[model samples]
Each structure stands twice: as C-alpha cells, then as structure tokens.
Target: MFKSRKNGVNRFAAATATHRQRIQVEHNSVLDSEYPFRLNFYNKPPAMDITIEEFELFALDRLQVLKVVEMAKIRNRSDEDYKKDIQHALDTYLPMKS
Candidate 1:
C-alpha cells in the first residue's frame, strides 16, 4: 500500500509538470499575438527599441488624455458630453490620428 501511494504521488507530480509546460507554451503564444489592435496596453511591451525620452513622452501623453476621460466620467456627464470631451482631449494630445 505504501509503494502504491508513492507511485501515485510521482504520477501526479509528472502530470503537474507536463501541465505547467503546456501552459507556458500557451502563454507565450498569447503574448506574441495578443490583441488585433495596435494600441499598447503594456501586456506585451513594444518590441522595437525606443529612447528613454520618447518612452516618457509617450507615457505622459497617454496619461493626460486618460486623465481627462476619467474626469469626465467622474463628473457623470451625458454620453454626448463625455464623447465631446474625450474627442477634444484626443484631438489636443493625439492630433495626428484625428
């Protein structure tokens, strides 16, 4: 009975190891593909090298735009008002796209 119990533990360990390896592979694949959108959610960082200054600039720009959107939400503005505010914020911060 002792020997059978040990064998069972060993089998369970081996199964757990295999499961972990499968999960690692799946995780890597998901990270590689991520979402279809080009926008960065920081789940998978930008692949290309960027200067520190550029990174900071990008971070701050996005932050300010998001802050504006958050403020609008907190104010409990109407949908149209929120949209207008967000559009203005995006236009000011991210003018090229619009």
Candidate 2:
C-alpha cells in the first residue's frame, strides 16, 4: 500500500528540491543548447528512432500484456488461470519472444 498524502507531499517537496539543485548545476555548467537531449528529469536517454509500424506493434504488444494483467487483478483469478491467460496472450501478441 502507498503512504498517506502528507508523506507523499513531503517526499515530493524533497525530490523537487533535489531536482532544482541538479538543474542549477546544468544551467551554470553548460549553454542552453549544449545540454544533451533527455526524456525526463532523471536524465533518461531519449528513445531511439522508431518507425510508425514498429511503434504500433510495440503499443499493441504492451496493450495485450497489460490487458491480461488487468484481467487477472480485477477478476482475482487463480494463479494457474492467470498464468495460462497471460501465456496465451503472449503467444497471440508476441510470438517472437519465445
């Protein structure tokens, strides 16, 4: 289970302060244009170039997996049933993974 709102707020404030320090370092050390492109504040690398077809395929694969996970959680399915359902989903959506 997650923490209460008060704890969440305190954690958020601490994280934001830490982020501001890193931003200040970046701003002082490099020109605006010189800073490397990143996807998020944690400095995650940007995703490699992907074609529309590839993107669609990846989305479909993820959706299939997520749907199975949701069904298992929502229905409170037995472990064996969940495993079989997820395996079937994987076989249908991501045959290459095997």
Candidate 3:
C-alpha cells in the first residue's frame, strides 16, 4: 500500500484486514436514542454492540485527535491554526454523521 505524504511527513499507514470477520459476527445491540451523540455527559454505560476492531479504531482516533491538540499547544500555534489543525485531524480520522 502506498502511504500519503504531506510536507515529507508520512500520514497514512497500511491497515491489515482484521476487522472483516469481527464485523460479521452475529450480535444484538440496543440503540437507545437517548444518547444519539457522544458530546453529552454520560448518564449510564452506552448500549451498543461494536466489534473489537471498531472499538480499537475509535480509541486510536481519539488519541490521535488529542495528540494533535497537545502538539499544537506545545508548538504555541495561533488559535486559528490550532483550530484548523484540530479540524483537519477530526475530519480525517472521525467523521460526524447526522
């Protein structure tokens, strides 16, 4: 697989096909509309059935986004630049759906 580069920085990595079987597993999940979004304070444990691979990806994305913010802070980037960097990270790693 070819990696995407920007400013001579390697941005993309090859992904192993490990999630296919996990995602195809039969599982019953509860989709409570009470928590349609993740930004709110949690009232209880979330009710969802996600594969291990998906969970791992979610965690990694969260860490990546946080890393971008922390790095921007350490670099003392301007507010607009910081926001842009965060937005780019979010858009690339996690997309919001309505």
The candidate maximizing lDDT is 1
Judged by whole-model lDDT over C-alpha atoms, candidate 1 comes out at: 0.80
Predicted candidate 3 versus true structure: per-residue lDDT over 1-98, tens digit per residue: 99766577333432344333454534324334565553657766567889999999999999999999999999999999999999999998888855
* Ranking of models by lDDT: 1, 3, 2
Predicted candidate 2 versus true structure: per-residue lDDT over 1-98, tens digit per residue: 97557544577788888778432344432233334444335344356888999999889898988988898879999999999999888888878763
lDDT string for model 1 (14-88, tens) is: 887877843232334454576644465876657899899998988898999999999999999999999999999
Q: Once superposed on the true structure, which residue ranges of model 3 sit more than 4 Å away at CA?
A: 1-48
Pairwise lDDT winner, candidates 1 and 2? 1
| Whole-model lDDT values for every prediction | 0.80, 0.74, 0.78
Question: How many backbone clashes are present in model 1?
Answer: 0
What shift in Å separates residue 33 of candidate 3 from its native position after superposition? 16
TM-scores of all predicted structures: 0.51, 0.46, 0.51
Error of 3 at 77 (Å): 0.4
TM-score rank order: 1, 3, 2
